[model samples]
Target: MPCTGQREREMTAVVELEAGGAKLGLMPDVGGSIAFWRCGEMDLLRPVSDPHLIAQHGRAVAGYPLVPFSNRVAGDHFRFEGVDYHLAPSFGGENCAIHGNGWQRRWGLDRLANSSATLTLDHAPTRDLMGQWPFSYRAQLRYDLRENGLSIGILLENTDTRDQPVGMGFHPYFPRHAGLKLGFAASSVWTNGPDHLPALRVPVEGEWSFAHMRDAGQEPIDNCYAGWSGSAFLRWPREGYALTVEGSPELRHLVLFTPPGQPYIGLEPVSNMTDGFNRPIIADSGVRVLAPGQKMEGHIRMTVTRC
Candidate 1:
């Protein structure tokens, strides 16, 4: 959102993809965010009717991406290799940089096909990307329309001459209903402090466990999960449909954000945790250091079916 202190690009045109009975809408200039995803008459990703709303809060659209790194970086600054870097706060945290640079900067439409489109973004330390994330990287978000749903492919390349900490994530919003249920398996949960940084790492159990399908109540849950099964299942009994999210192994973190009384649920597949940079040496933090010319890639697929 603009209140997050990142530059909000003006809304350009939306690129669309249609295959079988599914349709995917993407806004390349608006942080490369997805405006909508629909299967037949059913909205799969909580379609956003107005693009302006997405322009204001790029994350307000159906979904947006987290690139180079994901989640909070703590203090709006981070020191790497004895050098300090300053970043703009996102998600409205005054001192913490949240969600990465991809969701706030405009992305170029590299290639467009009938059922797929690719958006590209190049970040340079000198250019600042409006947030001054100190790294030179290339990110590409590819959206493909499938027969029953869609898939997103993320490719991040380290263009800097030295090693750089890089990771990627996807934030997708799903319509919430009283009869909705979610199922997933995770070995650990990273509890957050009042500031939303990682406070504790605890075993998944009780309310934190989703090993089997359970009602998705109107509860407040904003924690990151680790050791996931690489997938999650969401079903709506009353709606007679189900959705599945599959992620590549590179996506080691799963974040669930369910705010009370909100109409949508944020189910994210990410590569790192909140303030992961702070614990740079901890493998559990999910940070990956890439050498020059090296790249990392991951996939997230969403498939829907009749119940």
Candidate 2:
């Protein structure tokens, strides 16, 4: 079933996956985002039981796929292959295109099982969707349930006739506790400007540092760290367990969105940074241009265990 409209999110049916002490719920009609994830009664991602809530606010869902690109496109326009394309200000509150159209459109079930499923999204450029992304591509998300964990595999193919810049990742929302500590390694970070887009590239230091296990959600952060070690973990000292997030090497950037006062933290495994396509040094910005018919695949896995 297709998404009715922006406001009228008519839900089709939710796909449920269960195995190895894990339960996952996915709403194919609602941007194919994860509704809830639980491992033995413990919420892995921020669990949402209300289908209406998932339909209304996809941004608050447990997790979602970021495809064709991740994060913002900046300035509502970008120059590609010597031609300039202007992204319509699809973001209602801002004059920029953010987070691509994947997380807002509908996805179909390609296959399913007790613990494994595949969701597919075929996007042919449209005048409306072109406001956020003006490329033709097919995105496939393969979700597998593991013992006390879950794994997501993404495969994106450039279905366009011309070269198209592509990026992809998963945005998993994790519950943050008072004693939660995040551990990750990165060489540098892209600091956000007033517009919440990366304005400066700086070394990982001060509040931007996560090289060692440090308290998370205490300070506000919404930056994309480059040169990621391809893995990160959140340890809840008070809870006695840790959730480790591991991404494929191709997913070179990790976006940490720990908003102050918010109960959830988003540790996104992305292939590019905010506005990477518009960066001056595009070569080093993590954006890859895919030739016609070319495809790229990556995966992210999250496992839980006692600390």
Candidate 3:
């Protein structure tokens, strides 16, 4: 198990793995950031004022970016297989529910190695009751630390006898300074209204693009993209570190979110998409249809390199 940081008040645990002159800090709560992985700086991730920022610092489970459904689940209800599943509005909105109830839940930590650890989170059958969608599901998150890199694997197991439509994704905020460059490949992008719902699918035009490093700062993009090439890259040329995120072929979609004043950029790799219920993006990404007792898995791997 990684040792808890010397400062107990932080109340966060760190698992450090050293290789190639780089250390990986694995925080049990703050998701995965280089601070925990590389021992860079503490204040970089430990937010002092914003409770929500502190809440998201390094914890691994509780669903990183969003949950059972990322962004807004669209009234916590969706029609799947001709049946309507109404999920309670855990996110507290009129008809739109924001994020899912994954990050708020606790996850159990299993194996703890210097460079790796496995965390498991459960969604009881009752969790689905409030929303009208009922099913037993377990999500396991594994972080394998290696030299200058980390691999995050997610496994969603449907223990229910009836087939249910499921969605999951990672919402990691990459540290973005002036010297950072982000790159990814996508064929089409979705246009959205103020509510963050998909308004339409449009071809990648001039500036609202990720095909290359094309001024991601000037655009306001809270949208989903299909026909992704399956990989995304972020490079800090001045810092000499680059992080790579890739998903299985099944994860064919990506959500890029740029909030106006935030220092970090969110590159979300998801199995399904925002408002997938009405949009039904599962089929486009090869969303798995689990048998009575089956499991679906995907991974996001990152390698940090110092040039």
Per-model root-mean-square deviation over C-alphas? 4.2, 3.4, 4.9
Q: Which segments of candidate 2 are over 4 A away from where they belong?
A: 1-12, 47-60, 280-282
> What's each prediction's TM-score?
0.92, 0.91, 0.80
Arrange candidates by lDDT, highest first: which order? 1, 2, 3
lDDT of 3 by residue, 165-202 (tens): 66767766666566667788888887877776777778
lDDT of 2 at 274: 85
Best-to-worst order by TM-score is: 1, 2, 3
- How does model 1 fare in lDDT? 0.84
The candidate 3 region of ten consecutive residues with least summed lDDT is: 41-50
lDDT of each: 0.84, 0.82, 0.63
Better of 1 and 3 by lDDT: 1
Candidate 2 or 3, higher TM-score?
2
Ranked by lDDT, the better of candidates 2 and 3 is 2
Q: What lDDT does candidate 2 reach at residue 6? A: 36
| Candidate 3 stretches greater than 4 Å from native | 1-35, 39-67, 92-95, 127-129, 285-287
User: What is residue 275's positional error in candidate 3, in angstroms?
Assistant: 1.1
